[model samples]
Target: MGIPKWMTGKILCKTGADLVNATDPELVKFIGEIYYGLFRGGKIRQCGLGGRRSKFTIFPHMVKKLNTGLHVMIIIFLCVAIFFSLVSFGFCILNAIKVPYRAINGPAGACLWNFLAGGFVVLAVTSFMAAVKLHQLTERIANFRENIFRFVILEERFEDCFWICVASATAHAVNLLLIAISGIHFPKIKTKTEEVNVTAEDIMY
Candidate 1:
């Protein structure tokens, strides 16, 4: 059968349409230049775009909408994790005390995990609470600044508390990661085989 001219024309037209939207390497290079320009000239900010902002805002909102049972389980897990972390920190301190006496022997990974993770959890939580308190104190002072006769207003205290909280939280997150990695080896059980010269005779006896 002879090929139709109309069909061939339609195929060529579709190929041309696809080429219109094809990516250009030259255009990509131009985009790279624009990005560098924005950075060097300070013409653009690193703020979240619409899609990025939506993703960033979605997780907490989704968590807030979780069912009561799931919420309760989350709370329970959080409480237990916090409690165990504190205990681990205590164990770390005990291990530290015994370190100088050379009384403790074995793989220090577990002790390290307990100490670091627990201590970080405690430090982060305490520092965050302290930051909250400092913020409240700052607000109270600001509200009563005119009414009070001799008030020493320290706004810097809140900043310091916030930084401390940030550092502690970062440390706590690292500790959690370390603990998770170390936990893989924590519950290991080793089996040993014993050899005897007269194993059959001993079994008969």
Candidate 2:
């Protein structure tokens, strides 16, 4: 450790032996650095209690452990929400079908099936959106590595896709229940050419 002549002091030891004999804190630190540079291949010195402790150790102030109970509660809530929403949606379709049919007087035909088909189509679209999000969440949970070819774009797309899935699932499920209870009728196309095929082949009354 060559100390500049202008900065000469007790801390700047002329030799290794002199550094070993020094008692000042700064001098000891300087001496430690010199030996560290020589023996540790130009790295910082390991000395006293300081050497034993890691520089990267986290303070208690920033630590945040995940709450297991909260996670479980959230999953349970999702299950219930999905269940009730689907049930209500089904009930709405039943009511809509039953509206036009008066026992044996009015035959359940295209009108009933059409409404059911529309409901399913809307639900299917929503499910597709949810599936997209679920796929994104799955990827994130499974893969964390970023590739050189797709470092920026893939990650960004993954985040967007994941959030969209969550939002769409929640929105569609809630919307389904709302539409079911609101006593609303969604109009369907009624084509005269699309007649009901009621062939009495098996029934023997």
Candidate 3:
């Protein structure tokens, strides 16, 4: 999420009549091409000004400026989610290619892994939302390393990358439904049996 070009235009127009005959070359150039922050995946890129392309990652680069603990939590949850998703994928391939132990390769196992992945994805999303909304993440990122110009957020929205995470969560949920539809039985239900009691006298006889 980042500031839009229209927002920059609005801000420049708000600077009064001087904008019409701005003598400062820098100010004129800035009006022509304003700076905007764009967040994509793990990195933030500076765009829309003087062909200046500056990029940096969330880790190490901007960690000091962000809620480090919350950021780390988000990363950890995402990593765990990816691991579980991979495990589920491998289990699916195994189920298709060869017979495997029920504990590891059945619909139940798939459901378990999918559930775990979905849970972590939810955690990651929630944590990131908190970091962004409650903590002013985009504003913080936009202001990072700026010595002169200050960037104020005019509008912010989740970009495609963020929605992709949402889509992944949705996919995991759909996988759970598909696994259930595949006729999954609880382990206890599958192993249930009637028990017979034999008395000592019957045994002796």
- For TM-score, the strongest prediction is 3
Ten-residue stretch with the least lDDT total in model 1? 1-10
For candidate 1, the per-residue lDDT at 83 reads 68
Kindly report which residue stretches of model 1 are placed more than 4 angstroms away from their true locations once superposed.
Answer: 1-87, 93-139, 145-158, 185-205
Clashing pairs in 1: none
How does model 3 fare in lDDT? Answer: 0.65
Clashes of each: 0, 0, 0
Ordered list by TM-score, greatest first:
3, 1, 2
How would you encode candidate 3's per-residue C-alpha lDDT over 30-140 as one tens digit per residue? 322223222222213222244344455555677888888997887788889999999999999998898867976887898899999999989988888888789987667
Runs off by more than 4 Å, candidate 2: 1-65, 100-165, 173-205
lDDT of each: 0.34, 0.33, 0.65
Per-model TM-score, in order, reads 0.26, 0.25, 0.64
Error of 3 at 62 (Å): 1.6
Candidate 2 at 20: error in angstroms? 27
Ranking of all predicted structures according to lDDT, beginning with the best and ending with the worst: 3, 1, 2
Is candidate 2 or 3 superior in lDDT?
3
Better of 1 and 3 by TM-score: 3
Q: Candidate 1, residues 63-149: lDDT per residue as tens digits? A: 333232433443343355456556656655665566634323222544454455545445544533443254332222222212422
